[model samples]
Target: MMRLFIGGAVLVALAGCGETRDGNKPTGEATAKAAPAGWNAMDACATVGTPAVAAAMGKAVTGTALDPVSQPDGLRAGFSMCTFTLADGAKLTVLTREAADGDAYDAAVAAARKIGEEFGSPAVDVAGIGKAAMWTARPAALQVFLDDRRYATISLFGADFMPDGSEAARSAATAIARKLAS
Candidate 1:
C-alpha cells in the first residue's frame, strides 16, 4: 500500500535524527521535550519525553515504538505517535502533532471522529487541556486541540486509563500538551 511506503520513507528520513529521549520531566511537571525546531515523525517520541507516562500509568516505561502518521494521500503532515511499552507490558501511546495549517487540523479531527464512530463512540467533552478537547470512549483516546492548527491525542492500551475523570492523569496530560505547544 502507498501508506506503508510513505511511512517507511518517513522513518528513513527520521532515522537521521540522532536525538534520543534522555531528558527528565521536571518533578511535578508533565511536560514533553520540545523538539527544537518543530514536530515530526522523528521527534514525535519527544511528546512522551517525560516521566508523566510512567507516573500516570503507574508503571515504568521500558521501550517505545512509533506509528507513522500522515494526512490524506500519504503526506507526512506532522502526525506521529510514541507508543511506550510499560514495565507491566502495557502500552501508552501519544499521538500529538501541530499541523501546518488550520484546514489540515480540522480535517484530521473529523477523520478521528469518523473512525471512533465504528465502536459506537460517544464523545465526552474535556476541559482545561486545550483550546477545546473531547474524549471518545470506543477509541479510548483524548483529543486535545491546541488551537485551530494543532492537536494531540493520548491513548493507553492494556491499562484502563482515562484522563478526564482522573485528576493525576489530566494534570499530567495538560502539562505535556502545554510543553508540546510551547
Candidate 2:
C-alpha cells in the first residue's frame, strides 16, 4: 500500500511540471509564416504581359517588358522574392520560384489571393503572378505585385487608374514578398 501511494504521488508531481517538447514555457504554436521549400521568387511585373487587352474605357494597356530595380534588403541568397505597392498604399508580396516552370510561383500567387479574399476588404486588391504559361488569379487594382525567380514586380495605380510608380516601394515589397513566397 505504501509503495502504491508513493508511485501515485510521484506521477502527480511530474504532471504538475507541465513539460513540453522544447521544455520552454510551452508556447501554443509558432506564429511565423514560412513558405514551402524549393521555390524561387520573382518580380510581379517582370512577366511578359499578354499581347493586347481592352481597358476599362475600351482602351488598351500594352504589354511592357519588366523594368528591374535594385533592392539590397530584398535580396536573400538562394531565394527569390518580390513586392507591389497599390496607389492606395496596400502592400502585396510575392516570393520564390519565378521560373517559367515551377510550382512555387503558382503557389505564391494562389496563396496571396487566398489571403486577400479572406481579408474581405473590398479596398484590398489581390492578384496572381506569372504570364500565359503560369498565371494565377488575384484581386484587381490597388497595387499589383509579383515576385518570381528573376526579380520582384511592383505596380501602383490610383482608384482612377493613374499609375504611381515607386522604386523604393518596389524594393521593400520584393524583400517582404521573397520571405512570403512559398
Candidate 3:
C-alpha cells in the first residue's frame, strides 16, 4: 500500500513538471499565445503562428505543425524550425537559431545569402526588415540578416497563391523576420 502511494505521488510530480510555459505546453500549435523562451523551436513556431501567417500572406492557413524540429544548425546548436501549411497547397517554413557567437551568426547569414542566390540573382533586396534581407523568386525564399546576434528566414514551395506582385510576400516575410530578430 505504501509503495502504491509513493508511485502515485511520483507520477503526479512528474506530470506537473511537463514541458510548459505559464501553465501551457510550449508547442507550435496555433492556439498557443506564447512559447517557453528556453525552448527555441517552440518559441519560434508560436511567435509566427496561424493568425500572423494568415494576415501576413493574405491567405488562409490550413494547418500548423504542433511538433517542431530542434537541432544544431551546423554552425551552432539550438536551432528550431516550424512550418505552416497554407490553403493553396503551398507550405511556409520558419526557423530560429541561437548562435554560439558573432562569427557563427556571420557564417549562417553568408550561407543563407549564397543559397538564396544559387539559382540566379532573380532576387531583390528588401529594406526595413532587418540589418539586410533579400527575396529570391525562383525558389520563393526570403533571408533576413536580422542583426549581428540573430537571423531568420521564410521559404515556400508552390507559392502561386501570392499576389501578382512580390510585395505581399516581401512584407509578410519582413513581419515574420522582425519577430525572429532575437
Task: List the global CA lDDT of all models.
Answer: 0.53, 0.29, 0.54
- lDDT for each residue of candidate 3 in 113-159, tens digit (9 for 90 to 100): 55535556445777777667778664566766555434455766554
Instruction: Evaluate model 2: give its TM-score.
Output: 0.24
Winner by TM-score between candidate 3 and candidate 1 = 3
Regions of candidate 3 where Cα sits further than 4 Å from its true position: 1-42, 66-68, 71-75, 159-165
Residue 5 Cα positional deviation in candidate 3, in Å, after optimal superposition? 52
How does model 3 score by TM-score? 0.64
lDDT per residue for candidate 1 within 53-150, as digits (tens), equals: 76666667899777765442212235676777889775656765643334344444455555445446655667666566766554455667666545
Least accurate 10 contiguous residues by lDDT in model 1: 13-22
Q: State how far residue 96 of model 1 sits from its true place (Å).
A: 2.3
Error of 3 at 117 (Å): 2.7
Q: Which ranking of candidates, highest TM-score first?
A: 3, 1, 2
What TM-score, computed on C-alpha atoms, does each candidate reach?
Answer: 0.61, 0.24, 0.64
Scored against the true structure, residue 173 in model 1 reaches a CA lDDT of: 52
The 10-residue segment of model 2 with minimum total lDDT is: 48-57
Error of 3 at 115 (Å): 1.2
